[model samples]
Target: MDSYQENYQEEIEYLRKALAFIEEEVEKEAKNLEEKKSDLIAARKDMYENTIHASSDFESLVDINLHSMQINNYISSYNPQRFKNLKKMINSPYFGRFDFIEKGCSEKENIYIGLYNLMDRNTGRVYVYDWRAPISSIFYRYELGEVMYDTPAGISRGDVSLKRQYKIWNSKLKYFFDCSVRITDEILQEVLSQNTSAKMKNIIETIQKEQDIIIRDRDHELLIVQGTAGSGKTSIALHRIAFLLYEGLNSNLRSNEVVILSPNTVFSHYISSVLPELGEENVEQSVFDDLISEVFQGRFGEETRDMQLETLIHSRGKTSGEVRRQSIDFKGSRVFKQILDRLLWYYAHRLIPFEDVYYNGTILATRQQLKNRFLHNEIGIPMAKQLKIIETFLLKKVHPLQKKRLQRLEKIVEKSEGHEFEIKSFSRLLAIRQAVAFRERIRKFTIVDYRDLYMLLFKNHGLLLKLARGLTLPETNKEIILTTLQNLQKGQVHYEDYAPLLYLKLKIEGNDVVSGIKHVVIDEAQDYTPLQYEVFRILYNNATYTVLGDIRQTIEKTADGLLYDDISEILNKGKMIKLSLNKGYRSTCEINTFAQALLGEGTQQGYASIERHGEEPKVIPQETLEAMDRSIVEDIAKFTEQGYESIAVICKTQGEAEKVFGRLKKSVQLTLIKPRGGEVTKGPLVIPTYMAKGLEFDVVIGYDVSKENYVSDFDRQLLYITCTRALHRLVIYYKGDKSPLI
Candidate 1:
């Protein structure tokens, strides 16, 4: 055998020996733990059955407590999972290896990098280094020369003599590489060429230098990452979470202290396997609507962001569409935020606007009296807290009259002649009791909903006009406000209004600041407006943020290019650091080249060239809808027969998705993706374009790309989003003339 092959065989044999030893120890520990559990259970039973004498009671309690703690220690020490992880490492011991000689040290240190650290049990020396460890940076961030890495104490400079990667699987060495300056393309091409599964894979094994920088960053309070369509933005964000968890183990932080706000629930599930594979527990996960429900206490039937996205994708040319877009943009802007702040400040001291409280034809309290009381006391507390104080003051005045008022109403009911009069008297008594109890409810916080506040402003156009002057709002916004009021009257909420409402709610009902959240990582963050960022800042007041998004993929009109700039100012002054991931890591060069054309010339500046190459996307013209459907079915069957597991047929609107699914399901078995769809499963799937954001598939079939379907710039954005989701193949089918953009 060759020299390298002989060396690899020796390493494999050593790993197998280590694996056998670990497995044996794990079994012994498991047996010990079971015996300890049985002993603890018996001791608890004895403690419950024994009746201690008064003289021995103190001694008995102490013994039981001490015994319970000792049992816990035994259980803690008997964890077999660490050995189980070591057993897993036997198959693929390490991916990269390097020799580093420290500045003052003589002997060279050989570091082997893997998913998790493994140690020599007898010698207490690290046998395999975790990819996230400080010493592992030499494998990813340096060439075969001088290198330095930072530690808790300070920087450690060294000379990297050798850098090599191994592709070991199932305890066999498939290949090995000697990297000179950068990683060879052979490994990346092999990894990327594999078929994508339902779960996202951890990128630790082949994370690029750009991605490594983002994952290891912890010094910045706010990190704004603007990447192109396939730049691995979401992947890098998850890695960052994993890094924080590893770093948190030695500090005051915990895994649960970080939160990830994804674009959709399916996207959350898609990325659920990444952190666990990296040896960390899952963090908090939610979408924007869930966050709104959390803050609003799930009152007043709030609309979800998915439904709003569907509306934007389907409604393009109508007047309703225009007004909706206007409302979203206007309400999501900084100018409107200033208007909301003004309204909140003006009403903080006078939140309780009741005119008077009347009991038995006598005025117990007047509006002027309550106003004076509120203005005179607690001048600077939150509106919610201030209202609590007012409630206490008003209750003190109304309690004595409640008994007299109820007695008078009962007498009136007894003296009534007709049944109707008696019923009216009972109603009056109920109203009196409710009036007295209203203050009590206020003490528990039942403030008016944001719908009420928004409707009130619309009812008084003069007040809105006055607020508009402060921001130089265009005159056209007057119509937008009217349309929004109409929607609110029908009990429907616009996406743009959700944030402003939360802001108003916090201003009046006090901020419901959730504690213990040290970091908030947001994916598809360009979709968020300044108003939403304001709400996030208040909710997690002490949190650092990591925002990842692509401006080219901004399908919502509510978001603009200045979103990151506006948010940076709120996170911290000069503390927010901006990073860019320009290279496309998720798609092939051919796919990226076609997707790049969908954006404007200047809009593609942030995008970088990809290394992968594949077949260029094709635009096929057909004569009828039936013909297009037949072609898609045939293609899906062909792709599936060719061993493709995960495929998607993307449609422009929910209506189109449903129609296509109805037809496709009759001919072939496929899953339909809804706005509130569950986890995306394996096999052929039908989905709407908007719901397909932040997700990818092995093969994608664009149902229709006709001019009739894609007419506006927004429609083009949706098309851009759908086309980039394909990893290997893309086919666009149209009924009429081909789209000019294609």
Candidate 2:
């Protein structure tokens, strides 16, 4: 595994030879041009000379207009096919659209010509160059070196270096100078020239460097990267796509296979720009919530993700109503998962559920149809084998449909008697194949253990199995069928567990099941439940998983669910790469400290977390509910007083968040951050904890921690999540029980 630079050398050599050959041809053409071609030749020759006075190439010296003309005119002399190919290269859809796409090598390989004039539209100067040229290395890396180019007067040298890798677009590179190649902006700019953004393309590009290392590691097919806020996790993932493309894996690896399950749809659009910068199209960007919604839609009839997260965030912390909170906790805990495990065993042995029971289109009639199936030595057979036998029985039932199909085939064959005679055996084989396929399809209508499904759905536990089973009943039949169809459409559905998503902590330690994928990367992994982790580990079959998260930021803890858990302990694989990001560039230092203290203690500080100095947190304590409403209204005086545009009224629960949000909306002109809103925003907002999870604010007014809200165990995590949403300042006023997080 050589460095990109080393690989660059090998790839660049062949390119240099090709370039020299083109240059020699250009010189020859310059000689053979008709006498009228003298002006064009002299212009091409002189453009390079003048631009080179400060170290430039012919293309670097021309404007877009001239460069286009130059390329069109010169290419006009080549074969029609070659000329068309050249034009295609210049206008390829994928080129320059994304960093990864532009860098990805198409069938054209590295074939490119030395266009004497490709111009920068902004500067009106020729600056286009093929990426394979020696100077293009600056596009991928920061370099400092000088460059040497052959000239009519002999060798020309220029000092060059790069300030940043990303900002080097549309610049000429000068990497070769004084015999040895080195990394430098001066050398790179002089040797290679391309146009790119300097302002947005900061070496300080908000993405962290270590994340870059993480993304580029080729061996990691499933890198579970858990990055803290502002850790550049998304940014690095985009860069990894580019690295993969530049490394020639683009052909085998598509942008689709590498998927990213973002927190929300808004976040997906927010982070879509980076991939294109590397010339790669965006991967299949989606939110897991939406994906899940698609899976369970119709069956669940639009179960809202916001509502789920809201329920989870509202539940975590409590100081009162201990018993009620504990019940909520247990419902979402490993004990529940254990119960699920028991239920799964029962289902496997004697209670599997079925969505439909249509043997030959008529209703299955009764549970007896499925009960009898289990009585047929199904226990001794493997599950797949049992399915096979069920298929055979269903095929016999569908034999009538096949007879009709066979009649149709016979009619068609009779109409083509001459051809049928010559292809009788072939037609017979085709008929048999089609009959088997149709029989297999008809078997899909039969359900195995429909009784078990009904029990789970109508069960008293009200668990996920019930939720899943309920989808198959008469009322839910169409919905469930539609959802299953949706899952089939995406090609990613895998139905695996019957227990609480958490209960298999130890049972799967060594159980071999589905052949595990080599790597497992869980995004937003910190939000996963303990039982979910247990199941996830088994799903990966002991493959190394990179779990990235900030424990204090758990936004979806059911009213009593635990906010903090040990990933290393739960995962049971101690290959932990702990990353602490304390400095949040999104907020001022004053905000960071308050948020740090807001999470209570010891949970603060990390890899890139910085304290951006700014305003102290503003507290708005209300003497009465009426006074609180008026106070919040009056506080929107100006951005100067409290940076009102950056202010937020944080609520400990979704119900509470909605209450104050509605009140504030009617009382004042305060703006609220919509659920899953845009990141680039400025306004006074009243937001729920889960909705505000990945966002930041300048000033925050903590709403309440009454026993009805934060006093519950689940509200603890919600409280922690809400307080940390502030970027600069935090303000808290409690009218009841003190927040456990505080």
Candidate 3:
């Protein structure tokens, strides 16, 4: 214990010394700012003296030879090395002829000036602008905007164009640009454009700590970072991309090649300004929902309308239609692709060739006890002999059924028979021949009639309509109506089931819309199923992927089961990595302790982890549900009064959230925050626990903990999410039994 105390004392001493060193640095900065201020004054005075003796035309009157001789004499009189650059700089284009109108020169502000741009006389190309020299002050503030930053030995003010257009060579590339700039977003009559002031405190002379670290680590393909809400995680991510690009230099990576999967449209808007601030163009940004919709376009009406986001807003539940769910699951995962393969096999064996017999409320097919349509005996023979079977069937089917009426129907059946060569021996030949003949017999088609096959599609139109709504049914009266209506139609378009590669042919032979991106990042990765990931893989084939999410936060029932099992399976097993962020940096120390206590041993799961500190967690036992609602209202008002940025009454499900929100909204008049839940508005917000996953509040009041609501495993995630949202404080109020999670 004595040694520990000594170590603590030593740590205090070290911190004290560090503080002193920082103070000394601050003093040095102050001294440097003063020196710069004096230099500005000297330059202004010298310019005033030159103006008094100036010539109307610079080259004709003021002797450049005399100025150079004076600068040379000063250089010889003093240390030649000390004033070399300054001497050369003083004789610049508008050479020491300008004076700053030193009105607003105050503490910490150093004003200076220099020659502006050096343009090629013949080519009119800008060679350089002394933007970094101590001469850019006139362009920064509103004080000296009227005068051109440089002077040609005169005191007369000059007008400068807001934009200067030019073409120049940057390395091997020839670039043209219009460089227009606003200093403080204002326009003046005679705006100055030369040099400006540099405040010492704001001067960044060295790379920042995080920037240095990011620049050095260039090899890691995947970077998993969990940081505090304001800890610059996003800032670093953008910079990391920029640094990789700068290093990629002449290599392959370009600004267009980088992709950032933002959380939402509003979030994309929020981050849109960051990259441009770093002097790099913004990369492609989108939500995972966009990719999902693109993948299921023709087959399903899958929307990036996030199920969780919808549930929160629409007061929904886990989808109740089992068949509909099966369809969604099939399409949303690679399993759907496999199911397509299976269906193709079914089509190949003619298992899908069912005929409606009005049995079991669905169309049914029955197999004949004998060959009712007859069969070609040469079917099982070798390929060479099989050709003979097709040839014989075609010759027989295509033969003039009636030699007298052969002209109209002759070539049609003959041509169709050749198209159905295998079908003739396959028993369906007679049915196809009859369906085709009946079509031609009914319609005046000296043309080829492809209507018989379309009969089945038109008959199933009702089912197709319902399917488009993402619905599945056992059987419906609409099917009968559809069949009756289809029977009345003479000719309709039909789809032929082409073995296993029906829709797949369209996909495979489809044009690949190349997305120009080298890297794709999915922020909430666990919410994606294996199929969504595959679609992303296909869409951005040339891009490396970086996926990030807390699987515990994967509260969507339709997500990767929150087990992340699909991602694990699809990523070739161990190619998938699992990370446990044991330390929670978001909440307060007290809140962290209570939450860990609430979570118990389950908190140790790889999917669920939180920092060790936050506002204290509480359980307020109320008198009744109404009283609980009232208590939350009072607490929310109190939090807002205390300057808490966000306050939410988080509940397990959307239904529960709505009930609580409805009651408390009336009692407390709390603001009903829309999906655009910005910084805590004027009042508290009522939000679903799931919707509040990546959000936080100054205080969160758990609405209830009844046995039916809070103790169930289904509510465990909601509880975790709400508990983690307390940036400063959290309170859980319940009327009945305690929550299991609590």
lDDT (C-alpha) at residue 209 in model 2: 32
lDDT of 3 by residue, 265-349 (tens): 4345545654553345657877654543454343322323334344332332344333233333434545444544343333223
Q: Model 3 — TM-score against the truth?
A: 0.47
Regions of candidate 2 where Cα sits further than 4 Å from its true position: 1-204, 226-251, 265-282, 300-305, 308-389, 393-446, 449-451, 454-522, 530-547, 555-584, 605-608, 640-646, 666-682, 705-716, 733-742
lDDT of 2: 0.46
Q: Order candidates by lDDT, high to low.
A: 1, 2, 3
If both were scored by TM-score, which would come out higher, candidate 1 or candidate 3?
1
RMSD of each: 4.9, 16.7, 22.7
Clash-forming residue pairs, model 1: none
Native-vs-model 3 lDDT?
Answer: 0.45
lDDT of 1 by residue, 410-462 (tens): 56545653554446567665665566455444444325555577676666667
- Please, what is the whole-model Cα lDDT of each candidate in the order they appear? 0.77, 0.46, 0.45
For TM-score, candidate 2 versus 3, the one ahead is 2
> What range of 10 consecutive residues in model 1 has the weakest lDDT sum?
439-448
Better of 2 and 3 by lDDT: 2
